[model samples]
Target: MPRTREPFWRRLLAGTLPLLVWSLHFAFAYGLAAAQCTPAGMRPGGPDRALLGAVTLAAIGACAWLAWRAREVPRREDAGLLDWARLVLAVLALVAVAWTGVPLLLVTGCA
Candidate 1:
């Protein structure tokens, strides 16, 4: 049986959401916090400890969910080879989120 043509947007969504969220989380949670705090003289702690913590947690959770969604992209008989690459990206995204989040825990802000 012939496979149906999947749309490019669908493929991009399936592959990139996790990475996108991870990047957003890293930039906003850490970079924004640091930038905000540095100017305001928050020093060792950026955008309020609670706010930073919440952002970090949210990022991790979102990335994990995205990774889960990516992992669900069907690896069965009709699965496209791109599915493998997306799954890998999902895993990498999860790692990126965790790696970026570690600074929030360890540094508590910018060092």
Candidate 2:
């Protein structure tokens, strides 16, 4: 039997899930940092930090799982232009993460 093709939106979602997960991580990290530094009595090395750490780890795990599932999808030779656009956006996101940490460390003098 011939394999059934996945819908366009479903395929797009599969490819984009990693970006969504990483964006959520960035937002959560920024919010956590702000919360820690703000004058709200929420210390950095407390229960809140622990909770955020757990949540972040779980997000990472979920992202990995989604990526694996995405890889299992059958490739199409005739994707629409929009699909190509989404793939390009996903590549840019991956590149952003790859390059961001080094500059972040250099600017912050963390290295």
Candidate 3:
């Protein structure tokens, strides 16, 4: 049987989605931290660690889901470039999200 090819746009989207999520998470995390630390921007009580943590977890979960879906069913022996790309990118994003969240555990308050 011949291998079915995915559309160019779909392959591209799957491959880039993980990286995009990672980038967004990076920007949001740092931006939130910076904003919270600023005297004028700080929340009434303090930093919102819970919200940040929740977002981190959600990002990690999304990346994991993408990676799992990339594996696909039927267990093909010969996966294409897009398949590999999607799996690799998802795992990379998962690690990046986790690493980015590390400061949340170590740091408390803006000080």
Candidate 4:
């Protein structure tokens, strides 16, 4: 039988996209707040709330997409360990994204 081909982007990140996006979210969320907390980080107005909000939404969207893609993978009894690994990794990545995002709801600023 002929082997099925995954999309180029899918093949590039595949099972690790959620974690990658989460890393980006973390950098933007905490990193931005931390920067704003500093005296020189800004002119004293405060961290950019709008910017952070946008970042949070984008991160969540990416993680949700990753999880959706993971669920699209077929679950066959005959599937091998590698196939299983991809699904599990994607799920784990989504979990990581969620855990990292909870703070966004409760903490929204440098204060």
Candidate of highest TM-score: 3
Looking at model 2, residue 76 earns an lDDT score of 68
Cα lDDT tens digits for candidate 4, 1-111: 766676646555665565677787888777877787787776355667677767777777776776676674576766555456567766775676667656654664455
Top of the candidates by lDDT: 3
For residues 1-111, what per-residue lDDT tens digits would candidate 2 score against the true structure?
A: 776688767776756766786687667655655555566645534225455556565665665565444442238666665556455555555554444323322332111
TM-score of 3: 0.84
| Model 1 stretches astray by more than 4 angstroms | 1-5, 41-47, 72-75, 108-111
After TM-score superposition, the amount by which residue 98's alpha carbon in candidate 4 deviates from its true location, in angstroms, is 3.0
- Locate the minimum summed-lDDT window of 10 residues in model 1: 39-48
lDDT values, one for every candidate = 0.73, 0.54, 0.85, 0.67
Candidate achieving higher lDDT, 1 or 4: 1
lDDT of 4 at 57: 73
**lDDT tens digits by residue: candidate 1, 1-111:** 777598778887877777788888877876766676675666654456676678878877887776676666665676676777677777887788778777666655454
Report, for all candidates in order, the number of backbone clashes: 0, 0, 0, 0
Model 2 TM-score is: 0.54
Ranking by lDDT: 3, 1, 4, 2
Better of 1 and 3 by lDDT: 3
* Model 3 CA lDDT for position 74: 30
- Model 4, global lDDT: 0.67
**Candidate 2: regions farther than 4 A off:** 1-5, 44-47, 71-111
